[model samples]
Target chain A: MIEVEGLTKFYGAFPAIQELSFNARPGEIVGFLGPNGAGKTTTMRILAGYMPPTSGTARVAGFDVVDQSLEVRRRVGYLPETVPLYPEMSVFEYLTFMGSLRRVPELEDRVDEVLEQVAMLERSESYIGNLSKGLRQRVGLAQALLHKPEVLILDEPTIGLDPAQIIEVRRIIQELGRERTVLLSTHILPEAQQICGRVLIINRGKIVAEDSPGNLQAQLAGAERLVVAAGASCEQLLQLLGGLPGISSVRAGSRDGEVEVATVPGKDLRPLLARTIVEAGVDLMELRTSGLSLEEIFLQLTREENDEQAGG
Target chain B: MRNVWIIASREFRQYFISPIAYALATMLYLILGGIFFINVYFGLETGQITPDGRIVIGAMVTILLFATPAITMRLLADEYRMGTMELLLTAPVRDWELVVGKWLGAFGFMSVVLAVTWVYPLILHRMTSPGIDQGTLVAAYVGLLLMVAAMLAIGVFISALFRSPVAAFFVSLGVMLALWIVGSLASSSGTMGQLAGYLSFVDHYYNNFYLGVLDLGDAVYFLSLTALALFLGAQVVEARRWR
Candidate 1:
């Protein structure tokens, strides 16, 4: 568990994270969502005891981060954005060194265990510099897990990986969430949606929104979208859908020999529209009704935050 | 202490694998060899390279000035450049353990370099029929070793202050040169000056050990200086982590 109160960080005159406060309970995977320069890295560094907070305080497992840093460091495993590693060292050597730094009992055995867990046991002898980006990340994860700390703070853990590698890292992270506290920061919106139980959206060094994915979607409820494809011209489709009951607005696009129609808010007009389109002798290719995906929700949150700041 | 040993061993292992360790060692011994052979073969006419305490002492201290920075500069700079400092600083190991371990590792490297240079004296022995007096040779080697140990510590201390290897090298070299010069100048000035001269690494080697005397005061001076450097290195690292 962790507690943070009015945490602020200033790099000279510039504020990195300002008056930020949040708590993470045990066994929860909280996603830190933000755009670049949003202070996610700064916040994580403060929690990891790597950087001092400008004002306020953060506590990990009941110990003040600044006052009881050694204890806090012992309790948290931090993976920085760049995945710091010694190029000259083999994977096994790096993990062993990390284990000893944590003063882990049976360090060799612990190193093997983490290597196996990360699916890196076979590549233990490979020099870190020679490893591909994915394997290098795996090694970084292995080092963080070697100490078996209570909390894991990973910053952009899956950045720069291919799609498959991203999925692998995400699986490992989701597994890690079951038993340990996880605070993952990423700019990738869908990544947060898949693994995080709760989301904290930040912009301009401040927390703008915090909620579950479903709750966030529900907050913007009644914003239903309809994507339709018909044989009619785009303008004609837009005109017809635009005047329908319960429809807010309509836009027109075309692809694959069909006019693509976008209808705002209110739907189930699909059944009525199908009959009308058939009677009107217009071909219907596809019709679907859906709310915003998580990506849209994220952009909306950040855009709203930006708008509020600009308006003020 | 166990943690210190762990850190120290890892550092030593890294030095062995890296090119810097061999490069420094090779350069040191070659320079020492050149100075030793040149003084004996060429300086004999002018009595400049006589095997007296002064000539041997000068060679030892000069070798140290050339060699100490190579071992010490990379100690902290490489860690910063490689980003491994985060891994070390965030670990549970205390700041003192990290500092002392790294200092000892660089010191151990200096010892190995000195050990290799021993072959030079052996070569000199084989060349001469009766060979140089063993007692004076032993004293000269001891003085060189102690001076290097103290200078290596100073290098480690200065390295902790900067994340740049070039900067660390220049800063450490500047400090060592200033100290050595101060020690020599003090003796000619007055009584107080003479006392300062006694603290000079050059004076300690030339006046004491080079003369075939293993003075306890000289030995203690080097040991105390090593301790002071390592302590300051530890303090600098700790303060930086806090900031």
Candidate 2:
């Protein structure tokens, strides 16, 4: 539902984002994963029609973001990094004002629906200044969802929330992702992995990797490790496991009766190794696959990109 | 157009909800009331029952020179300070819509400020023996409204240039003072002096409208000045989108 091609934004002589391109499909929660100053906010602002890109183009729901900004704005909802709000206005008053500005039909009904969706219906009459940070963030979300746009662009939605509030906001985002295309940006690696269906790892204003969280974790590490516990001695199990066709290496695990077996890339040695262990008269207690965490994958990808740039 | 009205109404509502509007309105009425009472008292004591409103109009113009800045300082400056500009600019509304809406809001507030002083004319009508000229009074009030519109437009333009409302207030006050004093500063009769005299807002108001003269030239001058300032203010707002 969103397409950005050769999008470049420059502030004076310095480029904020250079030749960036990405897309978010319908009902897909695409996480823009990057560290601070990675140009994520710049890209989102361009997509939301807040500012035009210095060059190239971005289209949302098939409307040009620059030439057809009003149409693009009509079809997209944006929550800025700072969560822009008027503290003097109450929750319901703020939403009603935003609804009218967005030209939403039946604004009162839509306001109640959005307030309910964010679970903020009870505090609708309270002044925004009287609410906590988490509640204010919910009001921000309510405003974004008021018009029921096809696309939602959120920048650091869970930035300052406590752990529990983060989880709450994440749940709300996940629920919204089920019906609309959500393009959320965050420096928190776990947030991207936990909430986004697909992750776009952006570094230095460029996308270094893009895939599902599981796929990124598995593919970036190249080799898969397995922990096996059995009745046999460590030496005997190591010898037997190393001799298997696809087993690249075998070492004693940290546990008393466990062995760590490394498999070659794109190889499945579990069944063969199991059969060998069974025929050798060893009792197998446990066997499971071990994979790298998303944090490890992200750090490796960003570090590799940085090294490549430095070397080149 | 509907979007403009929506923004305007919201801004207008914001002004009324805050204490600043009430304070400013009360201060203005007291000042106008004091000037009206002193003028009426002195005129009646001198056996001239009809009180000419020129003195009150002169004082009103001088007071609005400072009051216009207070009313308009927060129009755009507060939006920047509070970071609401992001939400406002990112919406589907056009740049002109936001600018015109904000201008109308401040202008509407100034209307209320001007409306309360109508008691001055009413008192004059009731107490004066033969009564003041109704046509000239109406004409003078139109001139005052036009002057307020022009000054408020200039104040809005200045407000757009700064982020702090206090800074916007002081800078606009300085600009208005310069415009007010330009006529007196140019006492000689040369091309430069003539240009300065023509540019002076006080000269235009005192020489033409304060004496009950309804000159179309003066009307067009205030309107053109208002239009010019609003155009510049709109350009400033539009430039922000690019930066």
Question: Each model's TM-score?
Answer: 0.87, 0.91
DockQ scores for all the models shown?
Answer: 0.59, 0.72
Q: Number of the top candidate by DockQ? A: 2
True-structure RMSD for candidate 1? 3.9
Off by over 4 Å in 1: A228-285, A307-312, B35-57, B119-143, B188-199, B212-220
Interface RMSD of 2: 0.9
Q: Please give, for residues B1-243, the per-residue lDDT of candidate 2 as tens digits.
A: 988898888888888888878888788778878877777778778967555545467677777888889989999999988878888887899888888888888888778778777777777877865776777777788888998899988998988888999999999999899988888866778888888888888778878777778899889989999989988888998787788
Q: What class would a CAPRI assessor give candidate 2's docking?
A: medium
What tens digits encode model 1's per-residue C-alpha lDDT throughout A220-305? 65465667788777766766666666666666543543433334444466787677677777888788765677788778878998
In order, the Cα lDDT scores of the candidates are 0.81, 0.87
Error of 2 at B238 (Å): 1.7
Q: Which pairs clash in the backbone of model 1? A: B186-B193
Q: Against the correct fold, how does model 2 do in TM-score?
A: 0.91
